[model samples]
Target: MAVKPNQTTILLILRIFQSLFAVLVLALSSFVAHWYNTTTVVSSPSQINFLIFIAIFSILSVTSLVILPRVFSNRAVANPYILLGIEIKNVLFWFAGWVALAVFLSRLLFCRGSVCHAAQADVAFAAMAWICWAGSAGIAAVGVFKGVKKSSGNNVEVPSGGVKPEAVEKEAV
Candidate 1:
């Protein structure tokens, strides 16, 4: 029988995919930016620069979130709320970056070169990265909600000026 992977394993896989997509976006956007800088009178578009920034930020964020915990087993890197917040922000940044790049590409009247193709690939990879971030955010949100519910349900009510039953029992013994 094959062993089924748990939620943590699935989340780790998703993070790996997110990292790969971010790397691809970084490389492709860097290529297009360099091409424009060297070959064209106009500088690289602002959208490309934005994508580059997003890619670098995503790579660093994922590295810190996923890898740091393993390397430093004793230290707690971040709480669940912080992780969810970062995932949400990444989703928004990636969405804006890819949409801006797509718009810039669409505005070009005549795009028929390697640089143009590279830009198109960059947009695709950015979109994929956005999807991954969104997925991660959704998962994180669910986990946070579940944790809240579990903690709340475990609360034990005590009467006024009275200790918990377990505490009273321990004192009596």
Candidate 2:
């Protein structure tokens, strides 16, 4: 199947949204964690570390999903191998980003008794980021699924004689 320009445009838009959400998640989570840790007398080293890890992961995933596509798609030559590699990368980043968001959500929910006391702004930002990231990841996954299916659908098999057995039977009858 021929790839339409609209499909590419849609994918780019979704990726841009995903990258924006990822940036929000990183910044808000970091700021909240830092603020909570500094204010509270009881320090939680693990929580801070986890936030840092999430931020780093989001940065990497966003970079992969946002930057690599433009690089791969803009090549002078239409290399099938390069396209396939990019599809694989998209799948990985989308899945990873989704999982990271889930982890962040879980951490927020499971904190004990103001252990990770985030500011009102931080909480709001994190919630918004979660919603946006979920949408972005879902779109990316759909793109990956359709891409793989389309590639497979293109490789239809034909009979050796290029004629159906049903045709031969009908002729005989």
Candidate 3:
């Protein structure tokens, strides 16, 4: 029998894929930085700047996807408002990823033929990362609008301080 996927399962899968893409970008950027720096004495200043942005974006994207899913999935303490807030944050992070990836790609494109070889691998990886970030951000925005469900099993009851509602009603009569 095929198990049906739920919200938690879907969120986990997306987060995993996002993290994987982030890792790929991280690795490819690092390789580009190391290779281009050691092989050539004169390096494009923008190349290092692009590498730094990619590295920072990769780390933050991975961290947010890994941790925020857990926070959003825990039905035990799941507050719809809080989940909405967290999802908003996730959307912002992924949007930042989009900006960083765009800058990195533009920098790679404007470089010369020789530099393009090293950046080719980064281009492919960054494209994947860009797609992943876009999807993740869109999903988060949807979540914020859809709202999270509260647990059905637990209900709370309040005890009167000294008198019950019925008693208070009688006293006012």
Best-fitting candidate, scored by lDDT: 1
lDDT string for model 3 (78-101, tens) is 443454454455445445544564
Steric clash pairs (candidate 1): none
Q: Any runs in candidate 2 off by more than 4 Å, and if so which? A: 1-5, 45-49, 70-118, 147-173
RMSD of each: 8.7, 12.6, 11.4
Model 1 Cα shift for residue 81 (angstroms):
1.1
Mind giving the per-residue lDDT tens digits that candidate 2 earns over 50-154?
Answer: 544554665565566555544554343323344345445544544454455445646665554443444333344445545555555555445444443312223
CA displacement after TM-score superposition, residue 45 of candidate 2 (Å): 7.0
lDDT of each: 0.81, 0.50, 0.54
lDDT (Cα, 0-100) at 26 in candidate 2 = 59
* TM-scores for every predicted model: 0.79, 0.46, 0.55
List model 1 lDDT by residue over 3-114, tens digit each. 9986677778989999999999999999999998998899989999999999999998898778654554234554566767788889999999999999988999988888
Residue pairs clashing, model 3: none
Question: Residue 38: error of model 3 in Å?
Answer: 2.7
TM-score leaderboard ranking: 1, 3, 2
Best by TM-score: 1
The lDDT of model 3 is 0.54
